[model samples]
Target: MTDFTLLTVVVLTAIALVTAALLIARLAAPRTFNPQKGEPYECGVPTRGEAWFQFHAGYYLYAILFLIFDIETVFLFPWAAVVGRIGMQGLLSIVFFIVVLILGLAYAWRKGALEWK
Candidate 1:
């Protein structure tokens, strides 16, 4: 009836559905364990080097920058879908959002986050 009640119902329903699905899967799915499944492998060849080798921090910085821009795409899509209905206000808001993202990207670029080396 009320907004809070509707939200509570939706949350409870989602929890219940997820619980049921997981329980059903646990009960119905086949369980098989093999020794080969536990080993580290790649391209059907056994790995020779240490599995826990440290990577350069620059790689992580590049990934984080990519993820930030990727999320910008996610936000832009829904806004674009309702752009006509939202008019000038939404356009200005999204423009601001895009400007901020562009600034962030520029900062990353200037700092060489995009560079492989």
Candidate 2:
């Protein structure tokens, strides 16, 4: 009914759900014993070479592109759906939004964030 009551209910529900899930997992899990399980491995085989390796910048490029275009598409769809009613002001706003996004891409390019390797 009230904000505090709603918050309390949400928190309690989350706690109960998490507790239930953990309890179920603990009860249902296999108890097999293996000395090899204690050792660190890649696909159950011991790791070779360095334990850590540097990730490629391509991951960041993909993520940034996905974020930018994904958001652009999301915003553009709704605007397109109502294009006739919003007039020139809406058009200008979207143009401004696009310009800002281009600026972000330009900044990323200048910083060499798009480079692969």
Candidate 3:
């Protein structure tokens, strides 16, 4: 089978399995409802104030930087495995990629994105 057909079958099978599991759980699970369960916090701890609040931009910046470096490893592993066959060109390309990554990290560092406070 073609790749597209294989992907479609896999996706459909995943969806079907998830749906069947959910249906089975709903059918088999016991239901017990009480007045205490209707509260926002079922554990009985009272909320002090509004739960929603604006978060700092540094939090998002830090998380994005983390994800960028984290994804770099995903590319690195495959490149390392086939480095011998790819020769000088692949080595140079990865060097360039690493340089870019270093530059991005430096930029983020200078902008205080790495700072916790």
Candidate 4:
């Protein structure tokens, strides 16, 4: 099968499996209807303010910056394992990758994305 076909099949199968599982669970689970069940936060403590609230943009910026570096760190693990086998080329490639990430981080820093407002 083609790569696209394989991917489509895999995705469809996952969806079907998940749907079937959820259906079965819903059917088999005990049914106890309670007013508090409808509330998302039913931890016995009543909510005081609005359910939805706005977060400062700084938090999102910090999370995005963290994920960028976190994914870069993940890429380093595989390269580290094969470091000896692929000598200078691998080393240079990883160095280049790191340079690109550093440049991106510098750009974000300069853009005030890292500011803890």
Candidate 5:
């Protein structure tokens, strides 16, 4: 076989071996199930009812806003790191990015997405 084919076979074999070993370990492990174990354990507090429940839409809206601002913060770090090397062009680009981000925040504010109630 060609070198590439041989390398591919070796990699596939390694993966298959690992998978078989994991399956064997799982099968050999003990199986124990009890009423307490199946029930939802909430920090030692007994569950009252079904775990599934409807949450407020406001919570989701706030989460989305938080995510947007969080992503903006993430972008800022990388831009700050390369600002000196990129010089004027990078500075201008970052300014534009900040402006756009601010505009989005303004829009959200105007739409009352920032309001708690």
Candidate 6:
């Protein structure tokens, strides 16, 4: 076989072996199931009420807004790091990106997504 084919076979074999080992370990582990064990346990206290609960729409809206700004910050850090190497074109591109980002935030705000009450 060619070198590439040989390397591929070796990698695949390693992956298969690791998977089999993990499966064997899992199967060999002890298994225990009881009525209380299946139930949710919180801070040594028995869980009360329904496990699935609906969250307020406002909470979700705030979370989405937080995520959007958080992601913008994340992207900004890397771009800042490479700004010198990228020059004016990169700066303009980032400006455009930020403008688009601001527009999205504006749209969300206009739709009342930013309101707490």
lDDT string for model 1 (1-117, tens) is 999999999999999999999999999999899987777878777767787889899888878878888998799999999999999999999999999998998998898777788
Best by TM-score: 3
Q: Clash number for model 4? A: 0
Error of 4 at 71 (Å): 12
lDDT of 1: 0.89
| Model 4 residue 103 distance off true place after TM-score fit, in angstroms | 4.8
Candidate 5 residues lying further than 4 Å off, grouped into runs, are 1-51
- In model 4, the runs with Cα more than 4 Å from the true position are 63-104, 107-117
Top model by lDDT, which number? Answer: 5
Report residue 6 deviation for candidate 2 (angstroms): 4.7
lDDT scores for all predictions?
0.89, 0.87, 0.90, 0.90, 0.91, 0.90
Candidate 2 structure quality by residue, lDDT tens digits, 1-117: 999999999999999999999999999998888988877777967766875787876897788787876888988999999988999999999999999989988988888877776
TM-score of each model, in listed order: 0.54, 0.49, 0.61, 0.56, 0.54, 0.51
lDDT score, residue 35, model 1?
82
Q: What lDDT score is found at residue 26 in candidate 2?
A: 93
User: In model 3, which runs have C-alpha deviations exceeding 4 angstroms?
Assistant: 48-50, 66-86
Which residue runs of candidate 1 sit more than 4 Å off their true CA positions? 1-49
The residue pairs found clashing in candidate 4 are none
Candidate 1, position 61, lDDT = 85
lDDT per residue, candidate 4, 1-117, as tens digits?
999999999999999999999999999999998977766784777656776889888888888889989998789999999999999999999999999999998999898877788
Model 4, C-alpha of 73: deviation from truth (Å)? 14
Candidate 6, residues 47-105, lDDT tens digits: the string is: 88996889778998878888888899888999999999999988999999999999999
Cα lDDT tens digits for candidate 3, 57-101: 878876888899999999999999999999999999999999999
Candidate 4 residue 1 C-alpha distance from true site, Å: 0.5
